[model samples]
Target chain A: MRIVALAGGIGGARFLRGLLAVTPSSEITVIGNTGDDISLYGLRVCPDLDTVMYTLGGGINEEQGWGRQKESYVVKEELAAYGVEPQWFGLGDRDFATHIVRTQMIDAGYPLSAVTEALCARWEPGVRLIPMSDDRTETHVVISDEQGRRAVHFQEWWVRLRASVPAEQIILVGADEAKPAPGVLQAIADADVVILPPSNPVVSIGTILQIKGIREALEAKTVVGVSPIVGGAPVRGMADACLTAIGVDTTAQAVLELYGSPLMDGWLVAEEDAGTALDGVLVEARPLIMHDVESAGAIAQAALDLATEIAARRGTAPQGEDAR
Target chain B: MRIVALAGGIGGARFLRGLLAVTPSSEITVIGNTGDDISLYGLRVCPDLDTVMYTLGGGINEEQGWGRQKESYVVKEELAAYGVEPQWFGLGDRDFATHIVRTQMIDAGYPLSAVTEALCARWEPGVRLIPMSDDRTETHVVISDEQGRRAVHFQEWWVRLRASVPAEQIILVGADEAKPAPGVLQAIADADVVILPPSNPVVSIGTILQIKGIREALEAKTVVGVSPIVGGAPVRGMADACLTAIGVDTTAQAVLELYGSPLMDGWLVAEEDAGTALDGVLVEARPLIMHDVESAGAIAQAALDLATEIAARRGTAPQGEDAR
Candidate 1:
C-alpha cells in the first residue's frame, strides 16, 4: 500500500519503526514536522527528521529514543567552555555530523527538501522522508515568568524549560508564508492511506497542518491517527503541556475531537479509552502502549486495518486487497 | 617592552608561548595569519589564530603542537560516515566548538577580527590576538600533475597533498582587497620592537605583509625575525616547500635576503649558519632549535636582545633602559 505518515520526534520515529516492520518501507513516505527545527551554533538541526532517520537507519540510541548511538559530548562540552548560549540543548558529536552536512548543503543553495534527500542518500532511511516545508516555519511558545512575557523558540521552551511554565500560546511563525516542500502534496494525493503517528497533536502534526494547503490536502484523504494520549496522559514527551496550551484536555477523545471529523476518518485510542464516541469518524479502542517493537507493530497494523475498513465503507479500498 | 609579533600556526604558536614566558603577556600583541583560514562544513576554521590561542591558554596538544590537549575525532568520523568531502582535514570534536562559535559570530555580522577577540576572551590567551585581515584572504597554491596547473586551497595542498607536489606558484587570493584588521596597524606603530615568529614566511608572515601598508609599517619600526629554517631545512612544518614555491631556497641566508634590508632591521639564524651576512641589517647567529619551553624562551630572549642592539645603533633604544 502507498502510505504517507506524519511524524514528530521520538514517539513518531518509534512508531514509524513499528510501521516499517508491518509494511514495506519502500511504500512509505514520511512527512516529517519541521516546526521543531532549530539552528544551533550556526548549524541547522532538524531534531524530528534526524530522530526518524537515525531510528530507521539503525543509528539511533535505543535507550534515549533520540540522538545517535555511542554519541560523545566533547563538542557540547567545548561549546559550553566557549560560553555559547542555549547550552541546555544536548547535541552530541555523532549527531553534529548530520547537522553539519545538512547546513553545508543548505548554505550551498539547496533547499532543505533537496538537502534531506541528499542526506537520506547516506542513511538510506528505509522510507522516503520529506520535510513539511522548505521555508522557515518555527514554532514559538509564549510564556510569562520572572523573565516576563515573550515568545521563545520551541526548542528553548521544550528542551530548556522542560515545558515547566504554562504556555500562554503556541505560534506557528512563518507558517502562513510556507509552501509545502516539493512532493508533499503529491505524497498525500497519491497515498492509499495517511497515518498520523503518535506525535504531538498541537505542536508536531498540528504545526505541519498550519502550513498552507497541508490541512486541505489531508482533509481529502482517508486519515487514521494513533493517539499519543492514552488514558488522559501522553505516552512520551510533554505533549500534555502542549495540549493544555491549546486549551485541549489530555484525553485521546479530546485530541481526536481537536483534529475534528473533517480531517480524521478513523481514530485509534488505547483499550483504557474504549467506548469513546466521535461524530462522523470510525473510533476503535486497542492496546496503544508501544512497550516494544512488537507492540508498536501491532498498533500500526490496527491503524492500517481501520484505514482499510474506512476505505471499504467509502467503496475505495486499497487496490489488490479484500476488505475484511 | 611593548611588542608586536607576527605568527602563523604551530611554529608561531610555540614561539609565542616562549615569548610569553620571557616577556609579560600584557605587553605583547600577536598578529596572526588568516591566509590559512578555510570554511569546512559551513564553519570558519582559523588555524593560525586558534593555534596561538590554544597554545598560550594551556589547551593545546603539546605532542601534536596543535588542537586541544585531549581531542576526540568523533565529529570527524561521523562526518566521514555521512560521506562529506574533504575528509583529509582533521577537525577534532573539541576544535569544532571553536569554529561553531566563530561561524555563528561571523554570521551574526561580526568581522573575523572581532570574532577572534571574542574567542580569545574565553581562552584568555594573555596576549591580545588579532587576525591579519578582517577580509577573506585565502592562500591558494598552484600545482601541476594529471590535473594540470590549477590553484587549490592552501589546506588542500598542505593537508591533503602533504605539499608533496611541487608548487608552481602561491597566490594570496584576496590580499589586494583586504584591509588589516582593527588594532593590527596600531599595534605595530606603537610597538617598541616587532618580532617575526618562526612562521612560514611565504604563506604566514608574507601573506600578512601583502596587506596594504603593513610592510611599510614594519619597515619604519625596529623589526627582528627568527629564521624558521635551521641547517638548511624548516624547523617544523612545510616552510621549505612554501619558500621553494616562491623561488627562495630553504636556507636562513636565502630567507633573510628574501625579506631584504628594507623590512629586516635584524635577522636571527642558527649557530650552523654563523657566517650568514646581510648588508644594512644586523644578522645574529644563535641556537634556533626550540627544543622545549626553556629553549624557546631563550630564543625569544635572543631575538629581543638583537632588536635592542639594533635600536641602540639607530639611537632608538626603548626609554628607561640601556642596551645590553
Candidate 2:
C-alpha cells in the first residue's frame, strides 16, 4: 500500500521504524515536522528531521533514540570553549556535518527540501522523506519567569528549558507563509492511508498541519492516528508540557478531539482509554507503548487495519486488493 | 619594545612562540596572512591566523606544527561520508569549532579583524593577532595538468595536490580592492621594529605585502627578516614550490632580493649563506634552524640585534637604552 506518515522526532521516528518493519519502506513517504528547526552557531539544525533520518538509517544512538551512534561532543565542547551561546543544545561531531552540509546548500540557494534530499543521499533512510514546508517556520513559546514575560525559540523552551516553565502559548511563527514542500501534497494525495505516529499533537504533527494546504490534503485521505498519550502521559518527550501550553488535557481523548473527526478517520488509543470516543471517527483501543520494533510494528499494523476498516465503511476504499 | 611581525602559518606561529619567550607578548602585534583562508563546508577556515593562535595558546599539535593538540577527525570522516567535496583537507573536530565560530561571526557582518580578536580571546594567544586584510583575499595558483591551465585555490594546490604540479603563476584575488585590516597600518606605524619570520615569502609574507599601503608603511620603519631558506632549501613546509612559482630561487639571497632594500633594513640569513648581501640593507648570517624554543629565541634575538644596529647606523634609533 502507498503509505504516508507524519513524524516528529524520537517518538515519531521510532513509530516509523516499526511501520517500515510491518510495511514496505519503498511505499512510505515521511513528512517530518520542521517547526522545531533552529539556527544554532550559524548552522541550520533540523533536530526532528535528523532524528528520523538517523533512527531509520541505522546511525541513531539507540539508547538515546536521537543523535548519531558513537557520537563525540568534541565540536560542542570546543564551541563552548570559544564561548558560543546556546550551549544547552547538544550537537555532536558527526551530527554537525549534517548541519554544515545543509547550511551550505541552503546558503547556496537550494530549498530545504533539496538539502534534505542531498543529506538523505548519505543515509539512504529507505523511505522517501520530505519536510512539512520549504519555507522557514519556527515554533516559539511564550512564557513568564524570573526574566519576566518573553518569547523564546521552541528549542530554547524545549531542549534548553526542558519545558519546565509553563508555556503560556506555543506559536508556529511562519506557518501562514509556508507552502508544503514539493512532494508533501502529492504524497498525501497518492497514499492509500496517512498515519500520524505517536508524536506531539500541539507541535510535531500539529505544526505540520498548520502549513498551508497540508491539513486540507490529509483531510481528503483515510487518516489514522496512534495516540502519543498513554496512561495520561506522553510515551516519550515532554508532549504533556506542550499540550498544557495549548490548554489541552493530557489524555488520548483530548488529543483525538484536538485532531478531530474532520482529519482523523480512525484513532488508536491505549486499552485504558477505550472509553474515548469521537463522532464520525473509528476509535480502537490497544497497547499503545512502542517498547521495541516488534511492539511498535504491532501498533502500526493496528493503525493500518483501522484505516482499512474506516475506508471500507466510508465506501471510499481504492479498488486495489491491499486497500480493499 | 613595540614590535610588529608579518606571519604565515607554522613557521611564523612557531617563531612567534619563541619571540614571546624572549620578549613580552604584549609588545608584539602579528599581521597574519589571510591568503590561505578558504570557505570549506560553508565555514571560514583561516589556517595562518589559527596556527598563530593555537601555537601560542598551547593548543597546537607541536609534532605536526599545525592544528589542535589531540584533534579528532570525526567531522571530516562524516563529511566525506556525505560525499562532500574537498576531502583532501584534513579539518579535525576540535579545529572545526574555531571555523564554525568564525564563519558565524562573519555571517553576522563582523569583519575578519573583529572575528580574529574574538577568537583570540579564547585562545589568549598573548600577542595581538590581526589578519592582513579585513576584506577577503585568497591566493590562487595557476597550474597545468589534466585540468589544463586554470587557477585553483592555493590550498587546493598545496594541501590536495601537495604542489606536485609546477605552478605557472600565483595570483592574490581581491588584493587590489582589499585594505589592511584595522590596526594593521597603525601597528606598523607605532612599531619600534618589524620582524619577518621564516614564513613563505610567495604566499604568506608576500600575500600580506600585496595589501595596499602595508609595504609602504613597513618601509618607513626599522625592518628585519629571517630567511626561510637554509642551505638552498626551505626550513620547513613547501616554501620552495611557492618561491619557484613566483620565479624566485629557493635561496636566502633570492628571498632577500625579493623583499629588496626598500622594505628590508636588516636580513638574517643562515651560516651556510654567510656571504648573502645587498646594498643599503644590513645582512647578518647566523645558525637559523629553530629546533626548539630556545634556539628559535636566539634567532629572534639576532633579528632584534640586527634591527638595533640598523637603527643606530641610520641615526633614527628610538630614544631608549634598549634601542641604543
Candidate 3:
C-alpha cells in the first residue's frame, strides 16, 4: 500500500527503516522535518533528512543510530586546530561531504527539496524523500542562562548544550512564511495511509504539522501515529526534554491528545499504556520497543493494520485517489 | 632591514622558509600570488597563499611541499562517492576545513586579505603574508582538446592535467580590474629589498605583477629575483609549460630579459648558466637548487646580498623611505 511518513532524526529514521522492511520501498514517501536544519561553517546541515537518508541508505552508524559508519573527525579536528567556533557539534569527514554537496546546490539556487532529490540519487534510499519545506525554517530554543535570556539555534540547544539548559520556549523561526515543500500536500492527499513514525512529537512530527497546508491535508487522511514515548520515557534521544520545552507531558496519552482526533485516526502505544483512549481516535497498545528489524516491522504492520481498520470502520477506502 | 618577497606555491613557500631561517620573520612581508585561486565544491581554495602559510606555520606536508601534514582524504572520497564533479583535485579532510572556514568568511563579506590574516592568527606563520590583490583574479588556461578550444581553470590545467596538454594561452581573467591588496604597495615602497623566490615566473610572480599597482611599485624598489628556470629548464614543477604558453623560452637569461631592467636590479641563476646576461641588470650565477632549509636559506641570503650590492653600485641606500 502507498504510505506517507513524517520523520525526525534517529528514532524516526529507525522506525522508517522498519516501515520500509514491511512495505514496498516504492510506495513510501517521507516528509522530513527541516526545523532542526542548521548552517554550520557556511554549509547547510539537515540533521533529520541526513539521518533518514543515511539510515535507509545503509551508511548510518549502527552503534550511534546516527551519522555515517566508519567516520573520521579529521575535518572537525582541523577546524578546532584553526580555532573556528561552535566546536561542540560532531561533524565527521564523511558526513561533511553531504553538507558540502547540499550547501553547494542550495548556493547554486536549487531549492532544498531539489537538493534532497539529487542527494538521494546517490544514496538511492529506495523511497522518495522530500523536506517539509524548501524555505528556511530553523527551530530556535529560548533559554535563560548566565548569559541571560536568549534564543539559540536548535542545534546549539540540543547538540552543543546537550539539552542541559531548560528550554523556556521552542520556536519555528520561519514557519508562517514556509509553504509545504512541493509535493508534500499531494503526497499526503494521495497516500493510502499517513504514518507518524516514533519521532519527537514536539520537534519532529509536530514541526512538520506546523507547516501551513500539511496538517490540514493530513487531517483528511487515515493518519496513524506510533508514540515515541514508551513507559513515560523516550524510545531514544532526548525527546523528553523537547516535550518539556513545549509543556507536554512525557506520556503516550498526552502526546496522542496533543495530536487529537482531527489529525490522528489511530494511535499506537506501548503495552504499559494499554488504557490510553481518545474520543474519536482508535488506540492500540502493544510491544513498541524496536530491538531489531523484525520487532520494528511488527510495530509498523500493526500501525498500518490500525489505519486500515479505522478506514473500514468509517466506511471509507484505504487507497489513494488514483487507485480509488 | 625590512624585506618584501613575491611568492607562489611550493617553490616560493620553500624559499620563504629558507628566507625565514636567515632573516627574522618580523623583518619580512610576503606578497602571495592569488591568481591561481579557484573555487572547488563552492569553497575558495587559495593554493599559493595556503602553501606559503602552511610551509611557514609548520603545518605543511613537507614531502609533497603542500597541504596539511598527516592528511586524510575521507572528505574527498565521500565527495566523489556523491558524484560531485571536479574530483580530480586532491583536497584532504584537513584541507577541507581550511577551505570551509575560508568560504564561510568570504560569504560573510570579509575581504580575501582580512580572511588570510584571520587564518594566519592560528598558523602564526611569522612573517606578514598578504595576497597580491584583495580582488579576485583567477588564472585560466586556453587549451585545444576533444572539448575544443576552451578556457579551463589554471588548477584544472596544472593539478588535473599536470600541464600535459599544451596551453595555447594563459590568462589572468580579472587582472585588469584587480588592484594591489592594501599593504602590497606600501610593503614594496617600504622595502630595503624585494626578493622574487624561484616561484613560477609566468604564473606566480608574474600574476602578482599583473595586478594594477604592484609592478609599478616594485619598479621603484631594489628588486632581485632568483630565476625559477635554470640551465634551459625549470628547477621543479611545470614552469616550462607555463613559460611556453606565454611564448617565452624556459631559460635563466630569457626569464630575466622577460622581467627587463625596470623590474629587475639583479638576477640569480644556476652555475651552468654563467653567461646569462641582461643590460642594466646585474646577473649572478650560483647553485640555485634548494635541497634543504640550509641551502634555501643560503640562496635567500645571496639574493639579499645582491640587492645590497646593486643599491651600493647605484649610489643609493638599501633602506625604506622612512629609514632614508
Candidate 4:
C-alpha cells in the first residue's frame, strides 16, 4: 500500500517508526513539517524532518527522542565559548552535521525541499521525507509579552521560553505563497491511505495544511488523523500551551474539530474516550498509546483498518473520496 | 608588541602553541594558510586556522595534533550511509559543526576572514588568525599517475595519496590575482617580529607568500625562518615530496635559500645542521625537536629572540613590535 504520513516531531517520528515497521519500506512517504525549523548558528535546522530522518535512519538517540545517538557536545561548547547569544537549543555535535549539510545545500541555491531530499539521500529515512514546501515558511508565534505584541520564531517560543507565555496568534510566515513540495500532493492523492499521526495540530498539521494545495489534496484522500490531545493533555512537549494560545481546549473532540472535515476523514481517539461525540466525523476509539514498537505497529494497523471500516460504512469507499 | 607568524597545519599549530606560551596573547597575530582548507560536502573548512584556534584555545587534540579532542564520527557514518563520496577524509562530528557554521556564514555574505575572526572570538586562539586571503586560492599538485597528467586538490595530494607519487609541480591556483585578506597586510605591517614555523614550505609557507603583497610585507619586517627539513629529512608530514616537486632538496641551506635574502634576516636550523652555510643570513642552530610543550616553547622563543636580535642590529629597530 502507498501510505503517506503527515508528521511533526518526536511523537510523529515514533509513530512513523511503528508505521514503517508494519508496512513495506518502499510503501511510505512522509510529508514533514518545517514550521519548527530554525536557523541556528547560521545553520538551517529542521527539527521535525531531522527527527523523522534520524529515527528511521538508525541514528537517533532512542532515549532522548531527539538528535543522533552517541552525539558529542564539542560544537556546542565551542559555540558557547564564542559567546553566541540564545544558547537554549541543544544542537548536539552529530546532529549539527545534518544541519550543516542541509544549510550548505540551502546556501548553494537549493530550496529547502531539495535540501531535504539531499539530506534524506544521506539518511535514506527509508520512506521519502519531503518538506511541506520548497519555499521558506517559518512559524511565528505572536505573543503579548512584557515588551508588548511581537512574533517570535517557533524555536524561540518552543525552546527559549519553553512556550511559557500565552500567544495571541500563530502564523505560518510564507504559507500563502508556498506550493506543496514535489511528491507531497501526489503522495496524498496516490496513497491507499493517508495518516495524520499524533503530531501537533497547531504547528505540525496546521503548518502543512497552510501550504497552498495540501488541504485540497487531503480533502481528496482517504485521510485519518489521530488526536494529539489524549485525555485533554499532550503526550509530550508544550503542545497544550500552543493549543491554549489559539483558545482551543486540549481534548480529543476539540482537536478533531480543529482539523475539521477538510483534512481529517476518520478521526481516531483513545479507547478511554470511546463514545465521545465528534461532530461531522467518523470516530474510532482504539488503544492509542504507542506503548512499544509492537504495540505501536498494532495501533498503526488499527488506524489503517479503521480507515477501511469507515470508508466501507460510508458507502462511498471506492466510488468517491468526498464521503470518506 | 605585535607579532605575525606564518603557519600551516599541525606543525604550525604546535609552533603557535609555543608562541602563545612564550609571548603575551594579545601581542600575537597568526596569518594562517588556507591552502590546506577544503570544501567537503560544500562546507568551507579552513583546517589550518581551526588547528591554530583549537590548539591555543585548549580545544585541540594534543595527541592527534589536529581536530578537537573527544571527537565523534557519527555524522560521517551517516554521510556514508547516504553514499557520499570521498569517504577518505575523516570529518569528525564536532569538526563538521564548525564547517557547517562557517559555510552558513560564507553563504550569508561573510567573507572567510571575518568568519575566521568571528570563530576566533569564541576560541580566543589568543592571536588573531587571518586567512591569507578570502579569495579562492587552492593548492594543486601535478603528478604523473597511470592516467598520465593529473592535478589534484592539496588535500587529495596530501591526505588521500599521502604524497606517495612524485609531484611534478606545485601550483597555487588563483594566487596570481588573490589579494591579502583584511588583517593579513595590517598584521604584517604592524608586526614587531615575523617567524616562519617549520611547516611545509610548498603547501604552507609557500602558499602564504603567494597572496599579493604578503611576501612584500614580510621583506619589510624583521623576519626569522625555521627549516622544516632537518638533516635532509622533513620534521613531519610529506614535506620532502613537496620540496622535491619544487626541485628543492630537503636541506636547511636549500630551504633557507628558498626564502632568499630580504625575507629572512635570520634562520633557525637544527643542531645537526648547524655548520651548514647560509649566505646573507644570521643563523642560529638549536635542538628544534618539540619533545614537549617546554621544548617547543624554547624553540618558539628562540625564533622570536633571533628576530629581535636581527632588528636590534639593523640600524633602526621597528617600534611597537616587541611581543613582551
Q: Please provide, for model 4 over B1-324, each residue's C-alpha lDDT reduced to its tens digit, 9 standing for 90 to 100.
A: 677889998998888787778765447788889977788887788888888888988889889888889887877875676566678898886777677668768978999999998887777777878889999788988988988999998889788888888899999989888899997888888887888999988899989998889899899888888888899999888888988889898999898888888788889999999986666679999988887777888898898778767767776564553432
CA error at residue B38 for candidate 2, angstroms: 0.7
Chain B TM-score per candidate, please: 0.97, 0.98, 0.97, 0.96
- Tens-place lDDT digits, model 3, residues A1-324: 689999999988888888888776338999999999998889999999999999999999999988999999999988998888889989999999999999999999999999999999998887899999999998999999999999999999998899999999999999999999999999988888999999999989889999999999998888999999899999888889989988889999989988987999899999999999998889999999999878888899899889878888898767643222
Off by over 4 Å in 3: A320-324, B319-324
| Interface RMSD of predicted model 3 | 0.6
Which scores better on DockQ, 1 or 2? 2
TM-score for model 3? 0.97
Q: Write the per-residue lDDT of candidate 4 for residues A84-123, one digit (tens) a residue.
A: 6568899876776677677667767988878878887777
Candidate scoring better on DockQ of 1 and 4:
1
Candidate 2 segments exceeding 4 Å error: A316-324, B319-324
Q: By DockQ, who's the top model here?
A: 2
Docking class of 2: high
Name every residue pair that clashes in candidate 1: none
- Local accuracy by lDDT, each model: 0.90, 0.92, 0.91, 0.82
Lowest lDDT sum, 10 consecutive residues, model 3 chain B, at B315-324
Backbone clash count, each prediction separately: 0, 0, 0, 3
TM-score of 2: 0.98
Evaluation by TM-score, superior candidate among 2 and 3: 2
Each prediction's RMSD to truth? 1.6, 1.3, 2.2, 3.6
Better structure of 3 and 4 per DockQ: 3
Per-residue lDDT for A216-312 in model 1, tens only? Answer: 9999999999999988899998999999999999999899989987999999999999877788799999889898888888899999999989888
